[model samples]
Target chain A: MNNHVILDVQNLKKYFQVGKNLTLKAVDDVSFQLHEGETLGLVGESGCGKTTCGRTCLGLYSRTDGKVLYKGQDVHLMKGAEKFAFKKEAQMIFQDPYASLNPRMTVSDIVAEGIDIHKLAANKKERDEKIFHYLNLVGLNKEHANRFVHEFSGGQRQRIGIARALAVEPKFMVLDEPISALDVSIQAQIVNLLIKLQKEMGLTYLFVAHDLSMVKHISDRVAVMYLGSMVEITTSEELYENPLHPYTKALLSAIPIPDPDVELQREQTRIKLEGDVPSPINPAPGCRFKGRCKYAKAICSEQTPQLKDMGNGHCVACHLYNQ
Target chain B: MSKLLEVKNLRVSYHTYAGEVQSVRGVTFDVEEGEAIAIVGESGCGKSVTAKSIMGLIKTPPGEIKAGSEILYRGENILNYDKKQMSHYRGGESAIIFQDALAALNPTMTVGKQIVENLMMHRKTIMVDGKEVKLTKRLAMQEAVKMLKMVGIPNAEQRAKQYPHEYSGGMRQRAMIAIAFACQPKLLIADEPTTALDVTIQAQIMDLIKDLQKQLNTSVILITHDLGVVANVAKRIVVMYSGNIVERGNARDIFYHPKHPYTCALLEAVPRLDLKNKQELASIEGTPPDLLAPPKGCPFSTRCKYCMEICCEQAPAATDFGDGHEAACWLHHPLAPKDDVPFKTEVRHE
Candidate 1:
């Protein structure tokens, strides 16, 4: 419940051209705000443009429309020292730890890349000390500084990636599926480390992931995306307990709980979405989830539904609710 | 219930340059007829190796099944089967569906042709109008379309004519399921079948498999790392850790009253949606033991919180808690020292 806004995105859009004429609308008219010292989880299945939305918010990809404001300054329009300052203030932790870090570089060098680029340390000693400090902060020790990325396990390599992200001293971080590639036993370690670091450093995070259960665990608030559109946004507790959107209900029901008793008995209540996600390319001029929604009506296919606030900061984008 | 498959004292090792990696050591479990048994474990825990060994798909040179391993299918030991006998037993009696449908399916061949090929290899005749008719290639293709339709793929006839890449991830998985059930294999091995799919699509695929399994009475060996996935589908749960079975029990028993420290750690590790508060997840402290140089004692002894003095010296034997629920942990021993803190039974809320 942080009242201060760290980053504000409005009508953000990112489109990729496929061939001569085909355009894939990766992120379309998505808007959200990240509060300081809070984690906003963006949850959606594969190809729903959650990753694209995260990238566009950080100016990693040029937005085709809308604006991304970082501390009331247009992120896309920044230049020179301001842009560099923004880069240092905002960082990203990639999904694939294996590919994100340079295999040839030592772990120290990998962590120190952001430090050296930002010139945070004065000399070689200061740089090495800073690198070692970050490595230790992420549960790694001094012995792992000199080893190459390949020498480390998936969890360790992910630690190195986190060290690299935190080395820049970013107030805001974009964690794109940080734990998806990790093993089950190791995923909790990374999540706990992130939560601990966030509490200690007062860092704000935009955690984009498809794992809804884990997302709800770390995020203070959650946003649901469907086909490059924001379908729902609310507090993590409210979103899970009283989901208003049909897609959110279906998604929550689809997730198999580890408890066999509840899952077996609740089988009849589980909503199995009949078809796959609709194509984002040349999308229909209507609610993106209309194709799979059971309550879709005539108006659902004619006009795109806009996200409307339904009191207490809960928002949903569906014709049945909005109309 | 009759036993569909029985594995006993199975051990598997990989020939690495460093040494022989004991991927699976002394694993034993049995699958009853039409029962769904889930083999759950993390990476390098030898769950996949156990499934592969059961399917006879392990390559001999680099990967070897130890001499005493016994894989009995329908009262016959499949481990001793020759190549011809294994081939006949594999396609005709059992089949497997992989995680990555695109990678498992042939790219060049049509989906129909692939299913038809599998049918031709297994079936020679079909009942038509109460009379036995010789099954031909065309008839198999027709049956292939029907199989695709059975799995809920719309426009099955046209979709069958398309290549694997033409279908989406969920459709491809459905196609894979169709091919697996084409022969109506009495035993089906689904190795992380829904791991790569989305949750909604994952739900759909799981529902399809369960429906078909009931219709065909196919005993399934669902191998996966996610404990949540196996809850609804599998009647029995087998928890493995570092090439060993740490716990085996009914699904409800495993979820409600997990005895093994590793199982307790795992149950606590998974983040539940029904949790009211955003508390920290309890992760196991260390990584899995090295297969090449396995620990002298229990595999999970390094990370276990309830590890006792004797646990570091030798592996614990299985302790039965009645009704086929068993756990291999020193905490269950009668003479073991009681700790001040008690184990929590209900990790999740209703």
Candidate 2:
């Protein structure tokens, strides 16, 4: 219960009952803490439950079990007003800007929606001011406020999404692959804008993405997830420099280097994972990665490994590292 | 080295209500037999247009091939070919794999039927023992299964019966690849095939493309914005900006020692795993200029960090920068007067 800890999730579990008795463990036993004014990057491949985890954390989807502690308070146990206050404190930025924003609503209405719901604005003028303020913060001009979502470009729409998230004056935001839908040239602009806003507003973020390079660039600490579990978590530099988990290593190796000379000269020993990822419904006993892991042993299939700290705040979950 | 496909000064424009939007301007490049070439640029940079032009897929009326456009496939002018001739060239000589697998594929038809259709249409008719025999449906189905297996789609026989919607995004892309490779075309044009896929799936598709190209000995034209995706895949790189080929060279030369200012900016703009600390990513300010009235000088001059006065007034001719590396910029022009101004230090990222 540290004040520095803006949001802390303990053993979060979200399971969907597929059949009469079977359950699909979308997010099982996932734990992480987002500190004040810091970005925690959650990265994994598609269907790895990163999106589910983010949505569940935002209270959009209720967690089947476990606790989401916000500023030392249990969010699940909070009553009407308390939950409403928590909603104001934490906001989410969705992946697709075009779909996330209502097409019928103008930029002003879209951004001011949160403000209207929370009644944060004193009057119409104040609501307009707040909308423009957040818009300017995200690098959008006043003229863009009147335009609809369809009129703006992808990057601009994402900015409006960010502005909508910030309209509530949230201390922490869940950025779920915000830049993935944007162009490469515009990605840098958005990232920089996020950094500037974080610095100015003292905002904390849970930045989820599949792009390892961009995640490493923006995040203070990084967590690697695979098949509904946190496989590794460490400082951004440490995670990229010395990845401990086998899955993490494979994922990093698969990233194509931009420099062709370095790409060619570098021995690309791709750890070709055999077969597709196993289904989440009734997952096999022991390690989830045992099927694809090259170094997996009999012990790996028999017992699941817990995330253990290697050193210097680097935590990895693997039987190979346990020895 | 024989050139498999050569495009010279390709100019494609779309007739819009506002004006004629010139999509591609004087794009020239060559793909050697069995070599992979990449056209790298941002959206609206004419990379896709260049690929569409090569495939003769550019829709006319709105899109018209202006003068000074030449597309040579195996030393023959494909532009001059009629629709029937182009159809023969399409699935038989060269194939294109588009970005959206779901959109490109026929959702109602089973993957097997789709592949079989291409095979039946393109597979050369043969005679056995002085007796002509048409290809049977069974033979086409067998070839379709073979194509699926070649692209590494497991349980090909069963999966082939399933429609495109049943297949995952990666599998659909693989199926698209199967269709493209059914006839074993000499040249393959993959226009951002991995853009819609996840990184892992993207890697898989890229690997499949590379492996197939090697096995078939087919040249590839990879058009994409992701620099990393094209890093090891392409032998040569052509950097495009505002409908013009700004720089062209071997992949190694372009990545290691980029000559054009736009190329250098693009390389620096991309976030890399190797870069430590949040150094300012070099972003080219402003969007690409409108192609209808493209600037007289370098197309990138408006946003160029090293823009000179001469660059704004007159177009910089293509200048060779050793070892087949060339760039179109006033800085490289010998006759242009040198400026004392240094490159702009506008830090893009924090």
Which residue pairs in model 1 clash with each other? none
* lDDT tens digits, residue span B1-350, model 2: 89888899899999999899989988888999999999999898899988888988988889999876899988888989998999989988899999999999998899999999997888755344676567788878877888899888889999999999988888999999999998889999999999988776788889899999998899999999988899999888999998999889888778877777887877777889977768766666667787878888879989887787988988888877667777777775555445643332221121
Candidate 2: tens digits of C-alpha lDDT, residues A1-323 = 12488888999999999899898999989999888999999999888899999988887888999888889888778889999999999999999988999999999999999999999999989988898899988888899899888888788889999999999999999999999998788888888888888888889999999999999988999999988999999989998889999999888877888977677665456665545667888898789999889898999989989999888879898999887
Off by over 4 Å in 2: A1-3, A18-22, A123-125, B125-134, B291-297, B335-350
Prediction 2 TM-score vs. true = 0.93
TM-score of chain A of each: 0.98, 0.96
Best by DockQ: 1
Q: Which pairs in model 2 have colliding backbones?
A: none
Candidate 2: Cα lDDT at A164: 92
* Stretch of 10 with least lDDT, candidate 2 chain B: B341-350
Worst 10 residues of 1 chain A by lDDT: A264-273
Of the true interface contacts, each candidate retains a share of: 0.81, 0.61
DockQ of candidate 2 is 0.62
